[model samples]
Target chain A: MALAEPKTTSQTLWIERVPPIWWALMLFLLTMPAWANDFFLFQVMGWTFILGMIALSLMFLAGYGGMVSLIQMSVAAMAGYMVAIFGASGMGDISMGLPWWLNIPIAIIIAAIFGTLVGALAVRTEGIYTIMITLAIAAAFFYFTRQNYTIFNGYSGFNLVVPPSLFGVDWRQPMPFYYLTLGCAAICYAAVIYVSRAPFGLTLQGVRDNPRRMAALGFNVTAHRIAAYTFASVIAAIGGILLVWQNAQIAPGTAGIPAVIDILVIAVVGGITRPIGPFIGALIYVLLRTFSPDVLLAFGLSGERFKLLIGLGFLAIVFFSPDGVLGLWERWRTRRSRERDPLTGEQK
Target chain B: MTLVNTTTAADRLGSVSSGNALELRSVTKMFGALAAIRDITLTVRSGERRAVLGSNGAGKTTLFNCVTGDFLPTGGTIRLFGEDVTRFPAYERIRRGLRRTYQISLLFNGLTVADNVYLACRGVSRGRFSFIRPRENDALLTRSDELIEAVHLTPWRDTDVSNLSYGQQRQLEIALALAGAPRLILFDEPAAGLSPTERAELVSILNGLPGHIGYIIIEHDMDVALRVAESVTMMHNGTVFKEGTPEEIENDQEVQELYLGDGHE
Candidate 1:
């Protein structure tokens, strides 16, 4: 029998310790202020957290599972519409009147089902075909929602939504709401990290690299890809729930083409290779979308130019760093380290 | 425990005395009127080292593909341990202890060589869906280490597969096939791009493996084939033209004319 090779010191160390810098960063974020007002807590931070979570779901499929999907936000919108229709406000509300717990799980499950169907079909093809199929599916769902008022309430949409409440505390309250969003985002982020390092994650990567070889090694490549999509949908669906509660409304606009594109932009801007890439991108996006109009007004620019500025930012980031903000940050750190220590200056 | 885990290395090797690890009975596959491999009936007995020799379009690779479930044969049956597995999917056949190494190294380039072997041993220790971390499988880690050591690649085990030399990469590929402890290993041109010395080393290693690990090596290198394989099957076009000991094949006038063409040089 061949003997086991001894692991190197670096591998051994990485296996043993979780780096201290990450912990320090987490503590710093935890101590930051809840926010000075609802605008910061609920509107800006809340949207960022939810959009970031949605983008993170795409990251799981694209980066880890080697699947590109344009329907993640569309799936989220399905959950949003489902919640509105099923919650105490819309069509199902009057006809069925189900409790909050039952409604939310059903919304997520339905969104997951929608996501699984999309995944099963998209996974049949690869590369550009996968992208096209997902885009088509998202577009079809958007049109269906826009035209059907009885179910999705048509283009007029649905309103007067409420998040589940516990102990008489409105979880949707600005501060409480921000915490809830953060908590969910944190869990999703942690789960992505854990899964990426797990055996299944490595095997998924292996499948992406060489599906035939992986198949011969006993991996059901299609099954893994679909499972990955399903996992991504679960997170996106939760983001959708939080999003509807935040706006107290659900609309066809939420599931439209532009919203679907925005999720992709967020993933690209954050560096789709890493899970936290979405969060970084989400912060930049939410800040821009929230303040773009005000910033344009200050510059004597009209509302029409707000989108132009956002577009320019996207172009600038992509042009300067194809991997997005995370890529730029990595490059900057490597350059700084090289300047400080010329002996060992290579970047991974 | 052995019966429950029929795919395990010990279980597969234990059943070697029962018969050939793999049997192909009149297997044929066609793609649009072009017969890739036709009416190929072959048996690779347990503990046997068989070499399938042919030139470029002799369907050597095609036969390996059919055996490994890369493609289902259009006709006839394939048996693993006296049981028909003609319609099994690639993963299912692999689970039944049948594995193959590709002509081009199909290793995970981004990961370490050890990680490549670790993946092959992954399904062995636990189910394919095991959530256990790579570090948690000490038995697998030990097995992978043994494979790396057996291939004399302990020094480069931790290095990325991309960083290895061509010969080392080929060796690592074989190591990966061995990692799963398969009952039958199909090598598709194992010595394809290796140096003469490297080819010699591969033959030695192939010869050294225990009797339980049956192999069907597809090769163009006659020297390597003669050294390692216990039996030889020569193919012309897509069908086997002759089968016997290497000496018998070397002396056969028909094999020389059809497969070798003109001279034995």
Candidate 2:
């Protein structure tokens, strides 16, 4: 049944496929340390990257797999706890004092296993049930870590849990730490984007859209979903390690219910539709969190009302742009394009 | 009259050796007290084209669903290619060379036509969990492209499935079913909601399929069904009323009285 005209398009070079705007953005991020202050570099951007990575994991599950797992924050906390327990920490009785290379991989593996187990349990149900199951699991982890004194150090966790010195550089230093978190976030972002078009990612999307259809096409829907959790957990695990290093501590509150919900808010606000959405959401969240207290005080409100402010902002975003900031941006772009004539490039 | 009650071991052996593509014995599906289909038995040989025809509520779709493992039969066994797959999951049955298209278009609407075909091809093959994007020259990619062409959807390859017309979507449905080395495919109302021109195109596509790939089509369109199918199975109230050659079923007095009526279309 060969057709006379085979309409296969010629493949373009990989580098040429990337738009010019991404190059400009990469350059700006890479050179930020040159002009930005130490506090901005170490605290604001560093926190943004860490949160972004964790939220990216959530976005991957929610956007592609149709599984809005609240367990990602807990998974990150698990990694953070793993690092503190496996590697050096102020709590010598709790810490194992393993080497960085060993402990880091161990921590990620443990968290991934935890995520896979959660996935296994969560995927047995569908839709709103998935959210509830994951939330329950996350809450359980938070409580377990708080109560388990021997393993988790109880409510008060390990402090001085810094990153290992590598390449003659103190990784805890602001500049180095920024680059570290940035590098990790970049890798996670790129990996998510690359994998989205791959068979695994595409099939996950298919599973999300029509699970029965995917199964009929010979795909094990449950397995693909569980595998998605494993992939997402690794990224969240990296973010957790980086987060613990940034704060120099890990507490039960680090992965508390509030923190877990905050990640959901961040992912939703930034837009869960694309990989870049989580980062944008994270950046907005970090900026608002960092400056909103002062802004609230300036407006004659208590600085402690930051959560209220965040809640209001979240409500506003949800009310206006249901798909988050990315959806708003897309709408704007489409409208702009529609205004211009394709043949002459003149505004209609 | 080869109605030998095959044992599980013998069934497994005979499935492959006996040339039977599908075997369903006393298959039943119940939604609470209402039995959608009950005690339905069916058999189709390898490389045989068959049409399952019934009036609305006759449980033709339910029968397809039972065979495809979308709905586990309430009681009884379904053997695919000789293996007892009664309790097997849909994906397991699919991997065993069974594929099905939904009565309604159940496609990845957000994805492109090429992506949809590619996913279907990748489903039954190895490396389904691959994290690498298929290269231009990848075997599955080439196969997907060929299937798209076979369905005459080459021009709309890059278009999103949601953007495709009703006829085009129906065509894409057939393309998806044809992916991989499917031995037995279940097409549920594939000719439904298609234009007359599209129906002819679909008939041609069905007739042009490789000889060895057998299919059981559920069609309301008599002309299209009678044209593509060599044999016919007429169902009445979730049970097989008659099974005979297309000509025999077409001229049958009971079928005409029950289904076609006096002025048969």
Q: What share of the true interface contacts does each candidate keep?
A: 0.49, 0.74
lDDT of 2 by residue, B31-57 (tens): 999988888898999879999999999
Model 1 misplaced stretches (Cα beyond 4 Å): A1-21, A34-37, A90-97, A334-348, B1-18, B124-126, B132-138, B257-265
TM-score of the B chain in each candidate versus the native B chain:
0.91, 0.92
Best by DockQ: 2
| All DockQ scores | 0.44, 0.48
lDDT of 2 by residue, A92-210 (tens): 99899999999999999999999999999998988789999999999999999999998998999999999999889999999999999999999999999889888899999999999
Chain A vs. true chain A, TM-score per model, equals: 0.90, 0.97
What's the CA error at residue B67 for candidate 1, in Å? 1.8
Which 10 consecutive positions of candidate 2 chain A have the poorest summed lDDT?
Answer: A1-10
